[model samples]
Every structure is written in C-alpha cells, then in structure tokens.
Target: MMGRLARQGGLAVGERIRFDGQVRLVLAVTGRAVILSELTSEPRLVPPAALFADGDFEIVDISGRMPLPPLSLLETLPQPVLEKALWWEGHILEILHGQAPDAPQGAEVRPEYAPTRSLTARERAKAGW
Candidate 1:
C-alpha cells in the first residue's frame, strides 16, 4: 500500500480511503483529502494515501500471489511497470470507495458536542496540539 500511495504522488481529491475497518470516500479537504467514516462526524484528513488504503481487510492467503519478475526481484523496477502498478492500486481504491455506505441524507449530522476546553501552555507545547 505504501508503494501504491508513493506511486500516485500521494492521495488526491476523489481518492478512496478506509478507517476503523470500514471503507470511506474522500470528500472535501483543508490540506489533504477529507475521509468520512460511519462513526465519524467531520471528515478527518489522513496524511498518506497509503494509510487510507490500508484499512482493515481480511488477510488473504499468499500462495497464489504472483511472484515478482526475476528482473524486478533483482533490481529496481522500470518506470512503466511501476506506473502500471500505481494505476492498478488506484483502481482498487476506487472500487473500495464505491462500496462505502452512502452518506445519510438530511441535515448533515452534527458532530457530538464536546465542551470546549481552554488551551494550556503545556498542551500548546506539544506537537500539533
């Protein structure tokens, strides 16, 4: 999945993502794609497209997994092959998004209300607090 995300130059608008074992669609965004899930209120911006694609899916047996070409196994893959792999990866992501549950209609569900807390110097001192 990391390989796939790296190949796409990272996630983009319209890309699909998964969270908490369920697939979701990329909606709006601030800096990155906004990922919406069943239990989530506002969409969350995930950092890497790979992470979004790495949602909880059952592991499959690898016995049937195609072996990488001998050349690719020995050395770096050619650009065209890499591009093709990325395209396939993106295609899979699209399919996952298509399978996601439709967003419920009506007024957008309000996120659960949480009392706001004053920021503390200590909290602000932490990264991205």
Candidate 2:
C-alpha cells in the first residue's frame, strides 16, 4: 500500500511505473528528481510531478529486470559528454608526458588538477578522485 506522501514523492530503485505509454524502472532518486530507464535502456531524469500528473501512471507487473544501454548507444554519447572525454584524454596525456598536445593554455586549471604545483602533488591530486 502506498501512503499519500509516497504517492507524491519517492519511488524505490527497482520499482517499475508506467510512463508515456512505456513502463520504466526507477534507477535512482533524489530530492528533486527520479531517474527512469525504459526497457530499451533509454534513461531520463524526470520531475516527480510529471509521474503523478492526472493520476496518469499505474503500478504494473514487470519482470523486474533492466539491462544497461546498448554498447552502440553508450559509444555515441552526445557532443557535450564527448567533450569531457576529450578533456580527459588531454588530461591523461598531460600526466604521462608532462604536457598535453592541443591543450589550451589553461587546461591545468580546468578539472581541479594542479599540475603546476609539483609532479608529486599532481599525482596525489589525480589519485584522490
């Protein structure tokens, strides 16, 4: 049985709720949002209100299994995400060879790494994360 507050808020990580004509599994929850993944592994974060709007969704029986996104989808991340990967590539190169090629003058200050501090400090800082 769902309490009134539960109906208004929280969904557990494994619960499935019907959404947009597709049933989705709850992958995560935060105070402000819920992360849902469809059977095809399409993931999205949604506000609580949308799920409960017009009493639209239903608690449905499901197999309780969800797979990760397909490798092809994982490989083709959006452009902004790909930019971070490029940044990491530059970061790795900087660590290995003491400098990163095609890196902007300020790449060292980019991702909280302090390569200019000292080689040992750089190693320690990178290892911390």
Candidate 3:
C-alpha cells in the first residue's frame, strides 16, 4: 500500500519536505513518488525529478493533510520557513546570473587626475616679461 511504502521510506503525506532547494508540503505519498506543493503565496506542483530518494530534505515539521490549511494560512507559518524561501529566491537569481551569493554591488569611482594643459603665451609672459 502507498501508506505502508511511505512509512517504510520514513516519509508521509502532510510532512514538510524540501525539493529543488525549496521547502514543500507533501500532499500525497505513493510507492514511487510524492506530490508536493511549495510553501509560498501561490503554491505549485514540484516536478518528480526534484524529489530525492535519499531523503535529502530537512523535515520542517509533521502536520498531516487534515491540519494543513489552504493558501490563506501561509502567513501563519514559522519564521524559518519564510526565511528559507527568501534565501531560495535569491539563490535562484544568483544561479541564473552566474554570480556569487554575497558579491558586492559596484560603486561609482572618482578619477584621480584633474584636467591640465599648457598655459597661454600671455599668461606665461606676465610671469617674466
């Protein structure tokens, strides 16, 4: 049974699992796969490939399907999950741009030298003749 398989794998529906570097709420469990919805304002299905058979996810908490609320309850979630989401978003942007996560922003630099030119002949003559 799917439930038995899930237990054997130490995973269950309604448990928070991470996939694709983002935290997700498990919606269903099966012998082969799990259905997950990312923790966000607008949740979406995570592709099957993203799930790790090795159980790489950090289990945030255990709340089965019945207790899990709909989109309306996202605001009440714990602070760590929200912070992880923010970090994940920034990570994705960095990956796309090939940038370091902590890279500094460029600053405007002032040039060291002032403009210079030869003095006019009249000005030169005033100094000596």
Candidate 4:
C-alpha cells in the first residue's frame, strides 16, 4: 500500500514506469526531474512536468523490480556536457598548474587565478598540484 502511494505520488528508483507508451526504468529522481533508462542505449533526465503534461504514464506493478545501470554508467552526458566538462577541467588544471598569465607581457589574467598574496608558481605539474 505504501509502495503504491510512493509510486503514484513520488519518484522511486528502480520503478518501471510506462511513459509515452514505452517502458522505462527509473534510475534517479530529483525535485523536478526523473532519470529514466529507455531502450535507446542511454538514460535521459526528464522533467516530471513534461511527463505529467503527456498524461499517459502509469505506474506498473513490476515497479521497483527492474535493475538499471549505475548513474556513472548512464550515457546521459551528451557531447555538449562533455565539452563543457572538458573546458572546466582545463581551466581548473591551468589554475592548479599555476599556468597563470604572465603579468609583464600583457597576457590576460584568468579571472579565477588573479595574482594574489598567496601566489605560488608551478609548471608541468600534474593532478596533485
């Protein structure tokens, strides 16, 4: 009874839901989004409001029985996401490696790594920098 209530009113990981006339496994749920694994070889984060707008989803009795891949394994991060992550990582690495702007040569200082009192310079340093 409680499970049925949760399935109807709240999101439950491992639940099998019929959405848009297709079965999908619930992998995770946020305040306004649900991560669902469909048959597209990747999972997708969908807004609950969108599903509610469709008005065609139903909680299956087999809910909470379907197994899904871990969050890290889900191919939900698209190319743009990867690109952004790469850019962020590169920026962070630049700061950590102290590859800051050469103040004398008119190189633009990265906003995140402006020269400060606690400055230390590094080059060719790796992850632990």
For model 2, the local distance difference test gives 0.56
Candidate 4 or 3, higher lDDT: 4
For candidate 2, the TM-score is 0.38
For candidate 3, report its TM-score: 0.33
The CA-based lDDT of model 4 is what?
Answer: 0.54
User: Candidate 3, after superposition: displacement of residue 17 in Å?
Assistant: 1.2
lDDT of 2 by residue, 40-77 (tens): 65788888777666254765643222222334653589
Worst 10 residues of 3 by lDDT: 109-118
Lowest summed lDDT over 10 consecutive residues: which window, candidate 1?
Answer: 109-118
C-alpha lDDT values of all predictions:
0.38, 0.56, 0.45, 0.54
Once fitted onto the true fold, the runs of candidate 1 whose alpha carbons sit more than 4 angstroms away are 29-33, 37-40, 49-129
The candidates, ranked best first by lDDT, are: 2, 4, 3, 1
**Tens-place lDDT digits, model 4, residues 1-129:** 233333323555566787888888877666568789979678888897776555567776443223222446234688788668656655543543223222234355444443221223322133235
Displacement of the residue 87 alpha carbon in candidate 3, Å = 42
Against the true structure, what is each candidate's TM-score? 0.29, 0.38, 0.33, 0.41
Task: Give the per-residue lDDT of model 1 (tens digit) for 9-117.
Answer: 2233344444556666544333334444445466665654434466452222212112223444424668788778756654332232221123332323212211121
- Which whole-number lDDT from 0 to 100 does residue 50 have in model 1? 39
Best-matching candidate per TM-score: 4
Cα lDDT tens digits for candidate 3, 60-110: 765422221243554566888866865774443332222323545542211
